[model samples]
Target: MNPYFARSRNDRLAVGTFLFGTLLAVWYLMCVVLPHYQLSSDYVIYAHYATMTILYFQSLANFVMVTVARPDGNCKALQRNQQTESAHCDACGIVKPPRSHHCKVCDVCVLKRDHHCWFAGCCVGLRNHRHFVVMLTYLWLAAVYGNVLQWTFVGDQLGGHGPATWFRIVAPHVALLTGHVTAYQFFVAVMTFVGLLCLVMFSWLLQMQVVQIYHGQTQHERETAVTKYDLGWRQNVTCALGSRWYLVWISPWIPSPIPDDGYEYRTSAKTD
Candidate 1:
């Protein structure tokens, strides 16, 4: 099968899970969690959902920008600068910049290669690196927020009697088929579980990315303990994000142009 076809088919699971989880979360929150919170305070609901909406919108924007920014290596640009050694990638049929590598999945050489992200379905590299990191921040926040709200708000709404909750947790479908749970109960249980799972996954990725950004290293660099570009944390962040990172660290919509062309990086004294 074509790589694109295989990727699309594989990604359907992620897409479907995302859609289903979003729908289920909304339904449960509106029908169940909302009323509970509303009884406590209207401001809580307003603030709760307003923040959630902003996070989601920002996440959507970040996702779009990352996808649009495709962090492919600037081979022509590098050819002009000649800042460092160049490696010809037979796959991409071009001379890639130092620290750049070709992604077999993306079928392109990427600047400052991090890795091919299965979730994003893209090769994260120089240009989109900031957007990718910002995207991860927002998504991680969203996952954490969703999980907390789901568990705290609806913790009581799962199964009321005996091991019904555990049963639903382990086998919602089986519990439903056996007439041990209502469809609504089954959905609540499954969605809450999924929210926790997402939280765990996003937490790990975000943590790793944070360390990499702080150390001025890519995923590959971190793996090999490469310290060539391990500039100070502040400089490292500026390199990945931009000069005005202080201003736009919270959101990706703000502009903060990266200080240098991806062809050459500011090396650390540790490596020199």
Candidate 2:
């Protein structure tokens, strides 16, 4: 009944849903769909698969980083300032550094706390923010690519590309029970919807994160129009991501470390 625990509980469900959906979608694409093109002597699928493989693996790596990286404000800087300053987090018993906030779910104060990602079951903060954004970007790209590859196939299976077929795709359960669609058809319908939904969701998430980073703001700071930290978009990007912001989308293994610890920040009034 405790409200504080609800988010954590939902975090578990979110993790399960994310993993299950990802696995199912991957199986459909790699096993079911790719074989379709292969059997038809469509060797061109190899090129498409290679790209999808890259995007999927890159996104997966960044996803792991976002979940595992600790951006909590537990370093010597914040730890030494345990005095009851106005920015103090009583729960963490430490004076939070600039842009830091306590995460009840993680039970720690996150440096430059953007927000909690329930599906990842981790706080997106200074350390993982770059990975989080990259994950979303790759996920969105893969989803868009997958949708383009599968749309024609799905339309054919549903009996042509028409609104009538779309209605059946939308009401897949009904089509399945009514014997209008096979079990495979039903599953494909659901997965099709899932792919589109993931594309749309990731699109919004990527846009939001990029805009916030572009303006040197977190989700909270964005709402407040906090322009003090609004260095040029390029500087803001390098601040959140790293000096090599342009190259992060290529891979997370690249060692592009942020310049400083999360303890201090530069303001627009003093970019020196």
Clashes of each: 0, 0
lDDT of 1: 0.72
Return model 1's CA RMSD, one decimal. Answer: 3.7
Alpha-carbon deviation at 44 in model 1, angstroms: 2.5
- Give per-residue CA lDDT, model 1, range 65-165, as digits (tens): 66666566444674454444777777866667778987776666778888876555566778778887887787788887777776655557664534767
Evaluated against the true structure, the overall lDDT of model 2 is: 0.80
Worst 10 residues of 1 by lDDT: 1-10
Residue pairs with backbone atoms closer than 3 Å in model 1 (clashes)? none
Best by TM-score: 2
lDDT of each: 0.72, 0.80
What lDDT score goes with residue 106 in model 2? 80
